[model samples]
Target: MLKTFRWAFAVTGLGLVAGVLYDGWTALGLVAVLAVLEVSLSFDNAVINAGILKKLNAFWQRIFLTVGILIAVFGMRLLFPVVIVSVTARLSPPQAVHLALTDKARYQELVTDAHPSIAAFGGMFLLMIFLDFVLEDRETKWLGPVERPLARLGRIDMLSVCVALGVLLVTATTFAVHAHQHGGGHADKAQTVLVSGIAGLITYLIVSGLSDFFERRLADEEAGGHAGQHSEDAGTGRPAVALAGRAAFFTFLYLEVLDASFSFDGVIGAFAITNDIVLMALGLGIGAMYVRSLTVYLVRQGTLDDYVYLEHGAHYAIGALALILLVSIRYEINDIVTGLIGVAFISASFSSSVRHNRAARR
Candidate 1:
């Protein structure tokens, strides 16, 4: 475990030293708190990431560690907020960057202004993931009672989509009525949430559909070339490996989108601590690196196989997060509460798995 986290520790040490030098002990403490907050909020994200990472080939795995980390750290944590502020505030990206540096309070305000839409998009996307997982027929059942019933419902055409759309409609209607009651204030917020939610759903469909298409093509090609060849590398049965170059590309894209969906809440919650973008980026970047490292470690250690219910717990946590994100659009939930929900689910699942293992041994 120490070996796996050696780099994370090193990075944290350097960040703390830099933080202390830059702004004295307070900055150092803030960075430490932010990093810990990010890690706690994102532990389930690492588990889900590990589940996906196990399916990719070696080269793609390396890309996830290298290129993917870059995206998670810089692209999402730093550039993403800038892009959001720029687009929403009608400023250029460079101008947004300037604002972030020179006028952080205002920059934080702009980002907060955009949170309704961000929450809508991210929440819907994550909701679809959880719904699809629950609704799918799986050979291995973790929470069989809940899952079996959901799988039965999955037999209905587009049931997951239907459920998501219904929830979105209710959310929009509720908010729209609320805004109207408040003298038509924030009337546009409902529209923004609806549009953003649809956009997220569309993005998920397109990415997952493209990935499936490419994966099928690759499987066909492999079958034609080599008889008795498996689509996945010989291992514990997950989904078939997406082996074709194009398929791998799409799969990587899907993974990035998935990660982004998981990040929306954490990014917004960080604002409660401080409005300094530089500090937020640096602290969150350190946490993101540790999450990525944890993903790799989980995959390499076959932790998912050992803790069979862990992935199920993570997915359920995603479900909880999706709902929480949507609700947070109107009602404020403490970040600590959000983090605890994930932790609680994961803890319960881990405990259940241990009991199962013990019973099997007996």
Candidate 2:
């Protein structure tokens, strides 16, 4: 574990020193707090990433550790927020940078103001992930009480889509409208929210759909005339060496989009801690590195296979996070509440897995 996470620790040390050099101990303190906030809120993200990363080829896994980490740290944490402010504030990219560097308060306000659309999009995308997971026909029931019913309901074709769309529409009309009234009366609250929500749903469908399709193709090639070699590879405790080329690309893209969905809330919430974009990026970037390292550790160690229920807990956490994002369109949920809810679900699932293992030992 220490070997897997050495870089994250190194980065943490370097980032703390850089923070102090950049400002003072107060800046260092805020950076530390932000890093903790990110890790606490995103441990489930690392678990989910591990589940997907294991299926990927080693080459791609390297890419995830390399290029993917760069994207997560700089692309999502820094540039994406700038892009949001640019588009929403009607400024060019350079101008957005200037605004962020110059008028931190205005930049923060614009980013927070754009939260409604960001929430709609990220919420729907994550909701699709959780819905498909729970609705899939699988026997590895972590919470059989809830997952069993969800699986039964999966019998209805397009049920997940229907439910997601219904939720989006209802939310657009209700919470979104209320937001419009309170949120400076944006020209078309329902329209903006509905459109962003649909975009998110479509994104999930395309990215996840293509990834599964390519992976299935890889499995067939490996198994020849038999069933999925993806499963066969898993049974043998080896990655499907063929998860490269197009399959790797889409899987990589899927990971990035997934990271983006996980990051929207965190980026906006960082303003509460400190309005400095550079500090926010530095702090959040350090935390993101740890999540990435944790993901790699989970994959190499096959922790998901050992724990069994850990993935279920992570998905449940995703479901909870999705709902929180959606609800945040109207309400202001504290970062602490968000972090605690995820921790509770993950902790409970870990306990359950421990019990299951003990019973098997008997």
TM value for model 1: 0.91
**Candidate 2: global Cα-lDDT?**
0.88
Ten contiguous residues minimizing lDDT sum, candidate 1? 175-184
Each prediction's whole-model lDDT (CA): 0.85, 0.88
Candidate 1, 168: how far from true, in Å? 1.1
Q: How many residue pairs in model 1 have overlapping backbones?
A: 0
Question: Whole-model lDDT for model 1 versus the true structure?
Answer: 0.85
- Counted clashes in each candidate structure: 0, 0
Q: Model 2, which residues run further than 4 Å from truth?
A: 180-187, 225-243
TM-score attained by model 2? 0.93
Residue range 1-362, candidate 2, lDDT tens digits? 88889988998999899899998989999999989888998999999999999987678888997898889888988899999989987899999999999998888888888888999999999999999999997878987888888899999999999999999988898888887333456448778889999999999999999998988877665775256344334545545544436787898999999999998878878889998887888899898999999999999998999899999999999999999998898899998999999999999999999999999999
Model 1 residue 125 distance off true place after TM-score fit, in angstroms? 0.6
Q: What CA RMSD would candidate 2 show?
A: 4.3
Tell me, by TM-score, which candidate is best.
Answer: 2
